[model samples]
Target: MKIYKYILIGFLIVTTIFVSNHGGNVSYALFYLAIILPIISVIYTLYVYQHFRIYQMIDHKTIVKGELVPYRFTVSNEYFITYRSIQLKFYDDKSQVVGGDTTVEYTLLPGESIEKKTNLRCNYRGEYEVGIKMVVITDFLRLISITFPIQSKYRVMVLPRVLNLSRLRILPLEKDAKRTLTCNNPEQIEMDNELRNYVYGDSLKRIHWKASAKKQTMQTRKMTQNPRQEMNLYIDLCKLDVTGMDQIIIEDKMIEAELAIVKYCQKMGVPINVFYQQDGPQKRRILNAMDFNKLYQESPKIKFNQKVSVHELLSKNVINMGKCLVLVHKLEDALCIQLQRLKQNRAELVLLYFTSELEEEEKVKIGTLRSIGIYVREILREEELVNIL
Candidate 1:
């Protein structure tokens, strides 16, 4: 109710009393006065609350990058029946409007509602909330107005883009696959595996109490194995020096290649020794996306044809794997010589290379590798794997 309703009722009552008490022409005057005042008050009160709504909304609670999110907003009048020129604004964490701004000119019949919807895409990572700072509603004459806060914005967490390797992306093999090898059971060996020693996530049965006391660090239980041939998986992930293409694009390519090889071998039942050339010590297990926390200690330098020393350490493996797969990065002369020597001992060797920028020299070299039975292949692009296989 507006002030006019209250004032109109008060005047009507007072006029009735005065007209009855005076009992004359003034009664007629009172009747006219009561009518005029109430009408005026009704008009003024309706004018005050006419334009009245703002709303912000999102279709879902979560979204991933490169995907679309549907946004919906609604505006309506509570009491004053009037038209509204409405605008919906959406903002991100940085308080910047991102994509969902809209305007509509419509009238709200008494107790009526109107809604609008739009689609939005987010290319960046992190949680974003969509909000409207203010909503304005007005009367048909554009003289009356009201402002209200939208109920609230919805929060959406956008996950990072997934890496998809389409073709010949090369990744180095984990420790060399030797002629005959077995991954020893964990219970038999005795050593700490991950550095930070042990944390809450590790199993209690594997705790190295002695080491924990001595080093004053959590010691994770590690199995002592006759060290198997460890294959260092070196990736040339750096693309900064190369101009023109975006870093994230290159990262995507490399990530795709890495995941494909990991998934492929995992499916094939091969036990790999994995490592990033930028870091020291190799990870012997095939990693999944959730295993990112393990890479915290790893820092690898990206190079065009990065080399790791796992091939050189093959002779020390107590267990043999029967073969070695070096993918993505090129084999150095020393590593090639070692591979050749190992091949004579019944171990198979495969060398894979890829690029949109391979030179003639590299191309010819790949042919020479085939002549030596190194099983070398080059892919022009990720999608070209169809022809290679």
Candidate 2:
């Protein structure tokens, strides 16, 4: 294109010199053509920009992370002029086009169209645009090019993938394992006459129907002692001060690891209490497959911009005894203090530290955490979850 522009400039200069030296009919005609040539090229570029058409479709608007979705896009020329030097650019930050080159160029004849069918894979859990992001159009004379950003964005929501684990290596699953060290096969508690409002994980058999009818609210018989030793899973929702892509990778891994543990517990018929900071301190109890399904559906929309930190939540709601699992991206001093406090309180702590890269300082902290009897697993990538957990 630069060479073409230079040639056009040289032609214009020669025409101007001829018309200046001898004002003949032929010189004037050449000069006029030279002046009008660039005008025609600009008009042609604009015409192609307006007459070009693009259509894109996907098999579904929502997909699991790392799963390929069928995608197709078509580029067509609607006008009578042949479309030349059209280029396509895709969004490669969060999602990618599979099994083909990403940068594609095409030339379409009048009323002709070109379609490409390929698979698209989203790399993280979130809502983002994918496929072609912009179109580049160049004139026939190759003197100029205009870039047009695609207005219609193909956005899709990617949910985290749940791994079905036959057994969890994080905690012992043996029949003779201590009840305090394992989440499976918790001892059932006996109910007392004291009644309270029914919680999500409360057993249906323990519901006090007579007290509920009188109080106009569902009630359940309270247990004298603590209930079953449920697994307390805490997910850190505090936003990280990092680049956009780095943040997505960290957050997606955290979510997927948490979900994989939840799925394992569900398979073992163990109740789990999930804790995170949303509007404030939020908790969700998963008791069965149906409860796990609800959490899976809402995973993609979960945000990481929480005002409260996981350390603050743990301080306010301390667990004296139970199996607790904490998922965090950063190892801060305050969070470490909280984890140590939980360990001192006889709570079985399993810390899943997620990061794209681990630092030397974090390695020392991991050693300290392990010294305090806290099971610490540093997850550098998503694939580590399968073996580490």
Model 2 lDDT on a 0 to 1 scale: 0.84
lDDT values of the candidates?
Answer: 0.51, 0.84
Question: In candidate 2, how many Å is residue 341 off?
Answer: 1.6
Specify the poorest-scoring 10-residue window by lDDT in model 2.
176-185
Q: Model 1, which residues run further than 4 Å from truth?
A: 1-233, 238-241, 246-250, 279-284, 287-321, 329-346, 382-389
